[model samples]
Target: MVVLSKQTTEQYAYIRHCNKTSAFSSTGIIPVVDLSKPEAKTLIVKACEEFGFFKVINHGVPMEAISKLESEAINFFSLPNNQKEKAGPPNPFGYGNKKIGENGDVGWVEYLLLKNNQDYNSMRLSVFGQTTDKFRNVLNDYICAVRKMGCEILELMAEGLNIEEKNVFSKLLMDKESDSLFRLNHYPPCPEMALDNKNGENLVGFGEHTDPQIISLLRSNNTSGLQICLKDRSWVSVPPDYNSFFINVGDSLQVMTNGRFRSVRHRVLANGFDSRLSMIYFGGPPLSEKIAPLPCLMKENEESLYKEFTWFEYKKSAYASRLADNRLGHFEIFSAS
Candidate 1:
């Protein structure tokens, strides 16, 4: 009835076509935590440092919201192709990107992007905003829950960094508007896998890449295809933990913090016989902050960790290059290196 930890939720989660056990062998493993505990603070920090990854059970957020978002997204996408395509991102970049039919630029997934702020950039794109009443209402409610989670995490991070919660919230994101997009990725069972071998690989959820922003708040259902890389360069899959969304610092955060936090390299593999769903909340700093490194990140050597580039420029280049093959480039121009 309640989604607590990966163990408890596994019993309740609709288990289907789970080769995730195989994924453990296909992809090893990482640490798991319960962030709400006072003791877990150090453990989680150490886990992130050592593994750049971990899982948590009973972290926060409601299971109801997670289920609602997943169910609604599936329902929206299942609509006749024409209707679903109508909601496709019109902007081409931000929200309303296109729905990939067979072989398109973005790999094997379709999405709906939403922004709570009045982004003139998003408006400039020909993409249609969430106009469907049913979809909009459901999405808005779902987003409210996620926003709360993001804010809570930011505050927790402030404590972890020994900074005031207000400082973190003010420095990071403010309200629902700043440029962020949620991608609800659905990887259909491979056609090739079904007809003949029914075991062949055809699904490609997402190619390898670090999130361009500061942090990615991620949650996946029982479907297993997500993997994170280790320092030794092995890929490990973190099976979705119930109620707790896994958090990975992104490239932006690495630069802002002068590499105190590392952005991980991760990829989505193709599923052979089942559909998969994952939701990503890409959160970043306030609009007022420069896209460049913060003074704090550079204080160690009095050297900035990145080239002096605006957020807009970097992301544009990233998208154009499918995220520069996922190896977040070095900040050399102004770096102490």
Candidate 2:
């Protein structure tokens, strides 16, 4: 079994990144909403415009579903090497990896990836399907549940733009297309591989980075590694608020809106103890879709915020950035390069 060190329970509660001084001055609040209500329209719009990230208290996704996904993930990681290997290696698209973060240069974590809106019975079965039927079905169910809720949030973003809900969803999650899918991230504990305190003492949690999709749903176990950059150069910790879901806009939204939205950079620090497992649902359009900036906001000499590119092209570029550090994924293409 992959073991994680034990820290006090007090350590896990929402932690502010207190620098030599205090790290939290800006009060980062995620707007809470009940998507069923008419009032949620304005509330969600305002939330995205102001916070880029927010939490939904009354989203209809069942409490049981979220719990099950987390449990199964832990269970998968717990299995003997043979069962997981059935899924195959971490292919070009990031399916299965036993070495944790060691890609070309593995970090100290391991992960499994699946796309959103993907189909299993078709010509392209998930890389992990070779491993076991139960694994594939369980992951499939989790993706559907998260996407259902993700769609609701996308519709709200459309309302924020005052465009028909279908417009935004089309750009982010093309109808009838099972775009990229679920990524299971596991941060196994690392205690000895420490960096010099001078450069920047080794982080106790995940280094900073942001999701590449429209919305990322994260679940934190007893450990913590989430941090967010403020409008200022400083960064703050994203407290593990189990009662709500953390939603952040991705680079696509930042481009589509022509700068009205921000895809802030965030990351995770290595925890002194406790393995952190998180599942991120990437909402993407089909590789066939053109990823050019939306004309809706591209009018003025408004600084063509991003160059026109296809989803396939964009993801290739993102993978390169992920190589440097998770934070690189948060930067604009030019900056990442």
Candidate 3:
């Protein structure tokens, strides 16, 4: 059995007082598409164009798989801090504890990150160990199921864009060599957040940021904390739906569509009493692939908004910067009329 770490109970809440003024609207809603229906394609396109995020119901992943993974994850996090430390000394993979600050800002979450490359044997051994063989097996099954679902979504997206090369993204992202990351994020309860609520401040579980990937699939426990920033800058709380998955558009898709579909900025709020856990699977291109605006998406005289950059180069730049930094600015192209 895994032991608990002394610091596990420590609360790491960080409130950004300035952002407390940002209007939070209870009426703003995310489009929910039933992927199993015939209108899924159209609904998906509209959601991407207007919200850059949406919820999916009837996603086809076995409910039993989700339950097993959630239970195993809780057990994994419960493991002693030292055992968890074996998963990392650095950031690319393994457990990450909350850092106090780089510039007086901090997140109130811990996560176990794993790469989904072809090197599963070694990676599994390193991350899960032999004792948790059953856990590792269930995780692999979930990955396969999720990746299959992701490919189907990509196909629908391509069809929605009316791209002639309908299989372009599927070939690039679903390939065996494509680089993907599976992160198990745990947000321990910060009971102190009750004080923030009383004082009109927000306790952040995760800071506001845009994902730098092609697509992200998130499955969260039934605890409300996730919020998305709308076009008008209002924050809308995403209610918990245990049966659905939250899908978000990423920076790559924004560039690919030539700004037609935006990458939404989102954050998670700290819960006052209940802890939260989420599994996020990021689908990205192979590092060698270059990303740029699709020629079909741009008008004849319209200039490319962003220059072409390889996934490897972009990932490196993103990792070097702060979570909230505008990593895409480095690739923006200027037009001279």
Candidate 4:
């Protein structure tokens, strides 16, 4: 039972909890795509259309490597709170614990967030360099492998949309200088939730929000807590799978596709028992690349649903806004024609 800080408790008090529907099937109809098969593109297209999220197996990442990364994460996070805090407060990179934003909403989670670059500053390299070189090596390896898988998925997405393999969408992300972020999230058991609930609302490990990247790849330990919001605004719990990585379209992809694919809103619920860990890699284009609806996807007379914006600008604005606010709305353009 981890204790919440006084300020954090007050922050949580102001958050609006989602309607609990655990009675709803823990398993929603998320499509499963076998990356090694011939039907992979067709299946991925269908899943993107229907759910904008899917499970992928046979994605070419070795299971042992994944286990190693998970084990390393568990060991790092299991350190004493005082020791972990020495890694420093949350920024665009490094470790963060119970990070609360300007809106007074606290994320009941601790994470080691990293940029996918060797030269960038990292807690693993700066703090525990000599002792935890193995940890750093394993994490870097996992990031490279996962990033390769993400590019492969992007190619398939382009093929599905009948776009050229070298189109702007895929090319920008694959550029040598493209930016991506990884969050190794750990949500400890909040046993106090059972005794502390005054309104019978569920404990939110992370508040409901949509990812702003082009796409997101996630692998989690076998602990059930993640949930996705359907088009009907109802919540469906996402069950855990140790062997599969979950793929989700993000707000950038939605805009790139003219809303043909949605960036799903998802959240994590804390249970009174069992700790949970999830490794998420967020994919994005280079900071200078401007994203907007693809001209190829729109009819000649159709208006663009979203205005063009650079990832760098959007990211800075997003950090300043509430976590649950619709950041994409800021880039929307409306016309009466």
Candidate 5:
């Protein structure tokens, strides 16, 4: 069992735990889409509408790029605690541990958050030393491939919707000013959770929450910890496929579709022995972009279910709230009785 320091124990002690048996056993229920198929557009749309999440295969990203980045991330996380600390406390972009955000949400994870932009620089040269350039190159390669795949998926969604402008969704992400982000999370093995499972509770690696961006792409090692809440509110375990990427329709996408695509609420649990590593790319729009239901997607005289708000406003609101808070509730257009 991994022994936790007094501070570490206190940091995670107050976190909310869930029943380990709540996870659905059947993984076949999760949607799987092959991006190379001719029917991918329609399938992508269907998956988004139904699960707001799906596993994508043949997504055009090179396996070499994926493995290299994962290796680099592992090396960085393996560094001495002091060396890793030089990279951060994540002032919204660096390294973070246990604490999820400024809002007091804690988890059994440590992570590196980075802005996805042209000016992307290495996170503290001292952290990686001589391998900084290699790390940067690998990271850039991974981000480039993932961002392209994200744009492709969005265009496919527009095509499936039969929208006249196929680039309507993709263009936002392709924008140079897109407020995108990349994150690498490491959940170390916590055997203590198993010994303390008499109450049927498990440690939270990441709390349940919806992504706030337009879309998100996630790839993780072969670890069984991710769980997504279904429409009926039952949690289902997502079988890990390291070679494939999982796509999520984010809260922004949910609102832009006028609620057609519901954002999936998901969380992760700490494994008793195996560690879990995940990389996520959040594709966001430009800060100033006004988010609203596309006129083309709405029916005749259809009323918008949300008030128009800038991505900046929404993002600010999201960052200020707890992980499980309903970030969209403030932007909802309530009907007058």
Candidate 6:
């Protein structure tokens, strides 16, 4: 839980007012992909190219699983600070508060970051007490379902791009050593902070950044604070829909497509009256997996925009930098024309 001191509150506030504009007011402006549709492949590719993001429906994840995990998470977060601290400082994974990363970024949020594997079980068991088994079961069910949906989306992307191997992207995620991660973020309401602060700022729930993975699937409660930056550099709020999952094109995907797809920059603002809870599944490749522009994606004489690097290399660099840093810049190839 975030303690609301005047200094800390002021520090977390971000100045902006134009985000209230409805960017998705027009039909088809915000890509809505129905996974059950026959043309989903083409639509997914279009969404990746244009927005680096899209909303998915008919994704097959059980509503009971989603709600159950959310309920468990709320119960865990509602615990006393001292008790919750037992989950602790997140030395890469576990419970974390205010501090977003080791690189000095902070937000008005607390979160639990877990690896998508058995290793998270120990830490999870340590926190939930008597309900540990129930919490673990709910989390596992949710992760399993969402992982399947993520693979399906990746396969569709490959098919749409005419890649011979439909599973080229999905295979990495399915690998035994895949380094995927899941995060549950709780942005509590700050009713004490004046919405119309003298500086004209709103509290920052999470700072601006791009996910450093192959893809990211996000689902949040109806409380709206999530915003994505447009190509024109304008910020627009994404209306909440608890039943649907929002997909984000990640840095790895952008590289794999040779820049044909973009990694969207996005952030969250703290709501004044409603607490917001969100779950994000980051689909990553194995640590040793090589990352570079796919040869199949390049034109006959087109140059690779980025130098090759392993997932471990990129992840290290990304974690070392601030939230807003252009992490891909370090690996980008420059021609001395």
**Per-residue lDDT of candidate 4, residues 1-337 (tens digit):** 3332323243442223555454344454778899988788888878887788999999988887899999887777877777677666766467777775555667667877877776553444466656566777788888888888888888887887788743556566678878888888888876566557676565678888889899999999998888888788777788899999999889999999898888889888766567889999899888887888988888789888898999888888877887789989999987777
In the range 7-99, model 5's lDDT, one tens digit per residue, is 334356323345533644564877788989999999998999999999999999999999999998888888766777788878878888888
Off by over 4 Å in 3: 1-28, 100-105, 118-129, 194-197
Ten residues in sequence with the least summed lDDT for candidate 6: 1-10
Which residue pairs collide, candidate 1?
A: 88-96, 89-96, 89-97, 90-96, 90-127, 91-127, 117-177, 193-198, 203-270
Tens-digit per-residue lDDT, 107-177, candidate 2: 44566665453344221233235544555566677667777788887877777677753556634564666
- lDDT for 156 in candidate 3 is 86
The superposed Cα distance between candidate 2 and the true structure at residue 105, in angstroms, equals: 5.2
Give the TM-score comparing model 3 with the true structure, all chains together. Answer: 0.89
Query: How does candidate 5 fare on TM-score?
Result: 0.94
Q: Once model 6 is optimally superposed onto the true structure by TM-score, how far is the C-alpha of residue 293 displaced, in angstroms?
A: 0.8
lDDT of 4: 0.78
What tens-digit string does per-residue lDDT give for candidate 1 at 1-38?
A: 11101111111112133443235543445666676677
Candidate number achieving the greatest TM-score relative to the actual structure: 6
Let me know the TM-score candidate 6 reaches against the reference structure. Answer: 0.95
- Distance from true location, Cα of 58 in model 3, Å: 1.5
lDDT of 5: 0.86
| List of clashing residue pairs for candidate 4 | none
| lDDT (tens digit, per residue) of candidate 3 on 212-278 | 9899999998888888888877677788878899999999888888888889899887665777899
Mind giving the per-residue lDDT tens digits that candidate 6 earns over 200-255? 56788999999999999999999899888889887778888999999999999999
RMSD of each: 8.0, 6.1, 3.3, 2.7, 2.4, 2.1
lDDT of 2: 0.59
